[model samples]
Target chain A: MASHGLTYDGCNFFRQRLLLSTLSGKHVKIKNIRSRDDEPGLRDFEASFIRLLDKVTNGSRIEINQTGTTLFYQPGLLYGGSIEHDCNPQRSVGYYLEALLMLAPFMKTPLKATLRGVTNDPTDPTVDLLKSTSLPLMKKFGIDGEAFELKVVKRGMAPGGGGEVVFTCPVRKTIRPVQLTEPGKIKRIRGVAYSVRVSPQMGNRIVESARSVLNQFLPDIYIYTDHMKGVNSGKSPGFGLTLVAETLNGCFLSAEMSSTPQGQGDPVLPEDLGRNCAKLLLEEVYRGGCVDSSNQSLALLLMTLGQQDVSKVLLGPLSPYTIEFLRHIRDFFQVMFKIEVQKPLEDERKGGDKVLMTCVGVGYSNLSKTIK
Target chain B: HSERESDEEEEQGALKWKEGLQQKAAEAFLRQQAAAPNLRKLVYGSVVEAQESEEEEEELGGLFRVSRPQQSKKVQANTLDCSRFHPDTFHNWDVEEMLDSIRDCFVTGKWEEGHDAA
Candidate 1:
């Protein structure tokens, strides 16, 4: 491993830089993190993320300037085990869990994490979306076992988060390279319409309206109505819908929407939220890839780490986040992917142009996994 | 339309083979090039130029700096970190043609010759 470090500017792509740095065992320095903002520095959520990172690693060195405008991180060995974290309410637990998912398989021990905070929010990829989509995507790369699961213990909405989730992943010595050119046809559309501290009928209303949009396409549409009450419902009143379209090849693409957090702005009707979320699912199907938009980077990371084989994935047009992730992969592992666009034929009813990404993995293996 | 125009030109010429066939081929090639988006260039090449725009802060009267608070790209760098990709343009699902665009993605829709719904 090269002890020499890399540097970046701004706090943008903050998690990507840090997570990749840790995985690649490279030091990283980030400068001008909101340097010109009124309260210029790393936000509370970012600090919480750093604290979480510190807990999972051993011998890591982190430094920040007095104004918090700059950061230097020397990553340590991934020391994953049973751990608990109170994720900052500024961002949802999904934000922290995204990085943890990347680091978990390489850890010294199987990871069991109890994360407490917002479970569903409009700002990030919510917990339900990840459970339905990303975990399935990971399983394609041979990360599945009895221990692989993400369970939401309590329902929490944003702003005044009080939810809890437990995530567990079995360790892997090597990631499997995948060739996922065909995503297969979606056989069923499944979802959860959850309302917490709100009318239970809200969940039913959401399911009805969402089914109205999706039932035209497939007969196998099922949306579960979940109404959490009492202490299980978080400190706020909110409702949201997460829709996952399961394809024949076990690929999962998801879309979700949450009511405006209490006091944030104008509230949305459950029916409207349901209809919009269904439309979003249609949009995702139009994007039409083995991996959906949000999990593009995660799939790319696993591909990059796979044991020295050519990995190929068909994906939607690159998201800005995924584009930056590709650049970071190049920077950290000295790997660049062969990208090609496959346009749908003139009469084909498939959605848009797809990008085929081809890369040879770095053959990274988990030396930390202890042999029992 | 371009192909039709070329057909008209071929009819107008005494010898169609001598009528700028190479030029027409080059034009068609250039048109194809323009139509296809280069994904590799968009992902890696354009990011550098985007970051350079942030450096163009205008100074105001040697006392204060002019801040374009609404420069969305500049703000996006420091914006809330999220992985959700909001669509740039949404197709109205109410329209039949829009719905048909993705109809083949379902098991109920068309399948390739070798594959069956089974």
Candidate 2:
């Protein structure tokens, strides 16, 4: 098989095909299968089998679906019941097995993500503003590990029975069951999560914030999100989808675009013809876009965009309608997020996620303060 | 072709600056984003290569970051800066009040009842 380095262009190529929905654009569904044996080999073998098939096919699609006791199957299915039959290994090794699938030839996984609305942040990553923590790098990455993004349409119980999580992403694959050090037995380690929702109502808060903050901090973010909006078919569920907590630090600038997956309806180019097929396919993520965690520059940009420090740049002084929108936003955050800004990063502070929110306009005050 | 060239220029420019908020943003914004929580902040992606030893991490004073050096300078506010762009929009402040009350309830480090429901 050719060892072409994976890239955003390759991603775009797949995206275009998704838009067309050509006959050859098959989607490989990663349905969680119920298995008793917790053998690492079995896991690797299954993932490898799917990947190998992907290599043979010209360019296949991927659909990531996890199962547990509460898993739902679409009519007559190949895998049934919650695949989380074995509680420990299922959570632990199972995730690992699925992730390694990305390295295989058949594993051309489409990056999946969501966009949370922009909000005020006063503290920015500066030289100062933070202390430190005892979390190991791997564990930190595990709980909030940034890597090849994998998204799925999950069906499960919501936290606090907040309705059904339904289409939530659930957990990132990196976190797993581990044997606790020092005293006693074993338990599963938990990781943090962010949710996102995009809809008419969602535009009110998250997208509204994105309009201002995203434009100021991460302008390119809007470019990418807007460009890809056509390919994504994700539904807007009133509430915003939470972002991966790690990316939250820098996604200061946000935007919404009408994205359509790459290929709406078509076939592989005649010259593009090849004879391989893969089972696991990637799905196009639309309005709710997440940054590819592997791109280091993007993380930096997100932080800059979300930085609480007020840098002036003809941000507004717009028409009455736009100004009213800003007014309502401030009122909402003050009452809702009640975000606090503590020890704002001085202009010179260097390193740290020192930015904080105080639910006050101070987060974006400096220049705007005089505006009103 | 022109677009690719501009991107290269931007990337090169990003690489040259060593320290600044914009630089940090440039770094973090370019990193990978597989999965994360909501409240985390500006952090760039690294290769995820394991360190050689415990002492090595400590040797760097635990200040080693995998992303590129900072590459931005704080833009001094011009007249009608970004903040002034949308000066009047307001939102529901009640949610903030609720969270503040919940935070106050957790005098200790534990969640009490539905304290964390928000």
Candidate 3:
């Protein structure tokens, strides 16, 4: 393992660089973070993220210059007992939860995280989407039990967020290698149309329009309408839809769209939001793979950490985020994947080209896990 | 007879290029197929590496540095770090043809010979 600190420029993929550094136990230095921009420094959300990282680990050293343009982090052991965090409302809880999902399984103890902030927003994957898609994907990697769950305790929208969610995960000694090449035919589509601080009819309208678009292909589509009022509802009025297509082989492809945050942009009609979100699901299906677009990097990260065995996952075209993640994986783990493109047969109508990623895991075991 | 023989030679010479047309086309197609989808290179290519080295700064009067507005690549490096992959705008989902492209993904669509809805 290379103990020397890695250096990076700018703030893009900030979470990725830090997350990998923590997992690899290597120190990292990042500079020139929006240095040339006006009001140059780390944003509030990033500072909040760093705080969350500090809460999860023990003895981690973090230093930021006065300008917040430069940051140095030396990660400590992942001490993942129950922790509470007030995630910055600038980004959703999904932003924080994504990092937690990756870190939770390798912790010294079972993790119970109470995250508060926007649960549903346009910028990141909503808590609902992660609950529906990411948990199942993790189960395929042998990270499952009764305790492994993510529950949305409250609903919140962006701008003035007041949402809360509780996520729990059991620690694993060694991640299981998986061969997930086939994403069987989608048997059913399930969705959640949720509205907070708005008319309950908004959820129903979202469900109706979403089903109208989805019913063209499958009859087993059920969208649940959830309307939270009073204390459970967050500080803003918004509605959103999250749809998941479940394949027979236990693969899930998901898509979602949240209404524009209040006072941030043009308000969207629930009907339009539903229809557009449904179309986004179709687009996801067109890219058809064993893992949905949002969870591609997570799947790959697990593959990298699995016991020294070959893990293969068929994925759609790599997203820009996933591409950068691959580069960072190479930088931290020294793992390179064998990338193969699989063109659909001429007669098949199952969307675009697929890429099969094949790699041998580095057999990263949790040294912190206490043997029972 | 001599004139007819000369005309036959001329005809054969004129039609010579047609002899290897199919083979030439196949070779060209193979060459293209080999060059088109190098996924490994595309993912870890030099283009991404080039971004890291393009941090050239201009100085004014040997004291003040000119901070020109960032180019697209620099903007990407400093953009929000979100994981949600937005759908490609080129795919207009309202079009029937676009919807038809992914029809076979559902259970209602055509299944392979061995697999049944059961």
Candidate 4:
């Protein structure tokens, strides 16, 4: 069987429409083509999209949260997922507001986004069609705008909204000025992999215990034995934060960060932020121990970062402004989570050695500054 | 009013994701109900939120990408808020000893050797 003669036109149509939406100030939201909800109680559904092609999987149960999702398989073992703008507020406010501000002027009326979940997997195509290594999907996301085109900063809206519009969607051209992406660079390092936890199963044996709730999903979910949240603060109402997480198996590992009003947290200088996070995974959620690779199910909470020296790069050379921004993030993470920060080993800048930066911590907890 | 209804729908749309997340989170909590004493999923079950986050300088445009960022940072980024870490109260108590060892390693011009040894 030759090809369907549908590939090019299909991608072109998608690219054109997607680009049009970007110009109009909207974006497509892709889902994991390989994810499935198999927990004893989840609504067992799983359908995703392939970014390079315009296709919909049929019959396979897709885990969709649209209108409190339920399964609806086609005639075969096929699977399919829904497409729409991501409406997560407390989690994705940045993009929504940015859309509102940047595209507000381009629109005489409010803009509506045409969202779709793109799946790039071939072995297990989220949809029935398309090949793996989809460059069209890559091409779509790689088309960059430039400097401000790939950063998250404010311009006071009133006078700077125009500049932001230009930044978010530069020229609407086919080729990207710079890439706009965030890929994890996970590499292994030597360390005794152990599990930690954060929970409050019993009442005053732990009331609002911060220690009990500091749960870490990375490096795997080894619930910490360090129980210390305050009696009435762990699960309060006014907390400004809510921690959500998920592993590659789609097992969401997480916890809330916290601080006693006007107080610093338990300081924990990491042995090495890069190496620490690198050693953060596998299994620990299900058996609450090491993930026996072959014995596990769908993996979630993918954490990728490697051990590297932050000195020669981070503290080395750079334009004052950029370095300042990077340092601010690292320092802030240190104080906020009481963890450690170091330059990332992989994903280093091409021409320079300045790779990515990572923050590492043990366990999870809801440490937001709030009151009930 | 149409836009308002649309907005309401959109909010509802996003809400479903949240609720879905909430539901998954509850299950995740129950599954790993064994989370460490300090870190537990506030919204259990791993939810790979598909959003258009521009954290990568290598990725491309016009769509929402899913990457699990540090949940703490993710929350702050979404809220357009700032996060902080306290050097004064950060972990690691043996600063002087550690620093002395570090200084000694630096002077020997063999920090890696000492690092490997220690």
Model 1, runs deviating above 4 Å: B1-35, B46-75
Candidate 1: CAPRI quality band: medium
User: lDDT tens digits, residues A1-372, model 2?
Assistant: 222211111111121122112111222121223322242112332343333233323434444334221111111111111121111111222122222222111111222222111111111110000101111211322223344322322211111111111101112222222211111110111111112232333223333433332222122222111111211322221122111111222221111111111232332221111000000000001101122111112111112222243222111112222222222232222211111212313431111122222221122111111111
lDDT of each: 0.91, 0.21, 0.91, 0.22
Evaluate fnat for each of the predicted models and list the values in order. Answer: 0.84, 0.00, 0.86, 0.00
Residue B96 CA error for candidate 3 (Å)? Answer: 2.3
Better candidate number, 1 or 4, judged by lDDT: 1
Candidate 2 lDDT:
0.21
Error of 3 at A228 (Å): 0.9
Model 2, position A163: C-alpha lDDT score: 17
TM-score of 2: 0.18
Write the residue-wise lDDT of candidate 2 on B43-107 in tens digits: 11122422243234456544563332121101110111111112133322234332222121112
Span of ten consecutive residues with least summed lDDT in model 1 chain A: A316-325
Candidate 2: regions farther than 4 A off: A1-98, A101-199, A223-372, B1-118
- CAPRI grade of model 3: medium
RMSD of each candidate relative to the true structure: 5.5, 27.3, 4.8, 27.9
Model 1, span A172-191: residue lDDT tens: 99999999999999999999
User: What TM-score does candidate 4 reach?
Assistant: 0.18
Docking class of 2: incorrect
Cα lDDT tens digits for candidate 3, B1-118: 9999888788997878888999999999999986897878766666644554354432132465444332234557688899988644648888898888888999888999998989
Per-candidate TM-scores read 0.90, 0.18, 0.90, 0.18
Q: Model 3 TM-score?
A: 0.90
